[model samples]
Target: MAKDKKGTKKADSSASARMSNKDYLRELRRLHVEIVKLQEWVKNKGIKICIVFEGRDGAGKGGTIKALTERVSPRIFRVVALPAPTDREKSQMYVQRYLPHLPAAGEVVIFDRSWYNRAGVERVMGFCTQEQVVGFLKAIPLVERAIVESGVILLKYWLEVSPQEQTRRLEARIKDGRKIWKLTAMDLKSYSRWYDYSRARDDMFKATDTGHAPWLVADSNDKRRARLNIITDLLSRISYEEVPREKVKLPKRQAPGGYREPNYPLKRIAEKF
Candidate 1:
């Protein structure tokens, strides 16, 4: 063991430099496997659940969703990513559309951004009337309390990024050929009202944060860290009796078919490029 001049112990200094996203992807895949296992574990318990993800633009909310649901059974896991309300949707009661997307027994529903748009974007941008904004703020805690009382697991995540990071990521998206379209009118609103949005976001946390449904803040400055952190936090929230590893029944093999000889031996191709 060695010590620095200041008497700090030099501990485990041989590790590799910061890992690439590839490492993070592998870890996320492993966590997704656990989430699938959790669904079966919670099945008999009938624990309906929702994990709502919200954040500034370019905070990797969609990427986090990919990691969370990649291994979960599609039939049991649902993701909702809707656009701005249409004329038809605007006519209906606001919460009505979201009702159809809620989780069923043993199911998990992930909302890319749930109903909180009212408290954040709609408020800052004046999209919602002040009265409507107030209404959403007042109803949030009450509605969440009722949902929690119903034995549903509600985990909310707020993926936050520093303003500088936001600008960098947004600019990078513009330069990145594939992501230019991500800089949309709505996102432009967010960046323009960065301070206003921050205040509005704080209001959101204060208004809806309760013992029943608390906001899990995800430091989203780094995409890989955010993905890994969010998935692990969600898994910690759920409790299941046991996953039905034994219940996975494999079909019996067909009666031993007569062996057929291969027409050719396996061959390796050599590349000389």
Candidate 2:
């Protein structure tokens, strides 16, 4: 609730730091318990959850997703990140490319950057024709409407950072060599046109924010708080009854001694790479 003179979170060490030593242990226990319950709920109810995470590069979208799904079963919680279209994909409708990533009967499909790219960055970057951008914009509400009407629960998170903060992060990435590729030519061009993108982003909210698919602005200047908020909301949103922990099943090993044969001299090992 408190901020520094910069109006940034003073107590948050980083966008990705929230729980302390004691807090972390407690938080992990709570999160694990909830995840087990949610997994069972998914299996029983056959619920479908679709979440879209959109933000400028270096906004820690991937980091947030990691934290959120840390305790979740990989089989049920899927991260869908699309690569550039293949030649065949280029010929098909854009929406078709994303269908394989949609939630199964009882799964969560989190799209890193969705089809809405046409209305936001694509439009601002001239990657698509004016017709393409306009068409996507006009169709967004209807497209989401259809998805929800078809019984898919959707959540869209907009992770936002100050322009100055974005610049700092981009520069740091370039120095780090970890994610420099994300800062593409278009991104550099988009830099000078920050105002243009801002206008376009505002336009996106105005035109496509429908009743069924509402948008939540995530203050991602602090990654920890944002991820915490994002995951907490996700946990509560999916319709599920409380799952009795005692009713859950755990996979059992078939070893006769009730433990793995110890090939691992791990406890006595002292060698380091």
* Each prediction's RMSD to truth: 6.1, 5.5
Candidate 2: regions farther than 4 A off: 1-29, 177-186, 245-270
lDDT of each: 0.82, 0.79
- 268 in model 2: Cα distance from truth in Å? 14
Candidate 2 has a TM-score of 0.79
TM-score for every candidate vs. truth?
0.81, 0.79
Task: Score candidate 2 by lDDT.
Answer: 0.79
Least lDDT summed over 10 consecutive residues: which range in candidate 2? 12-21
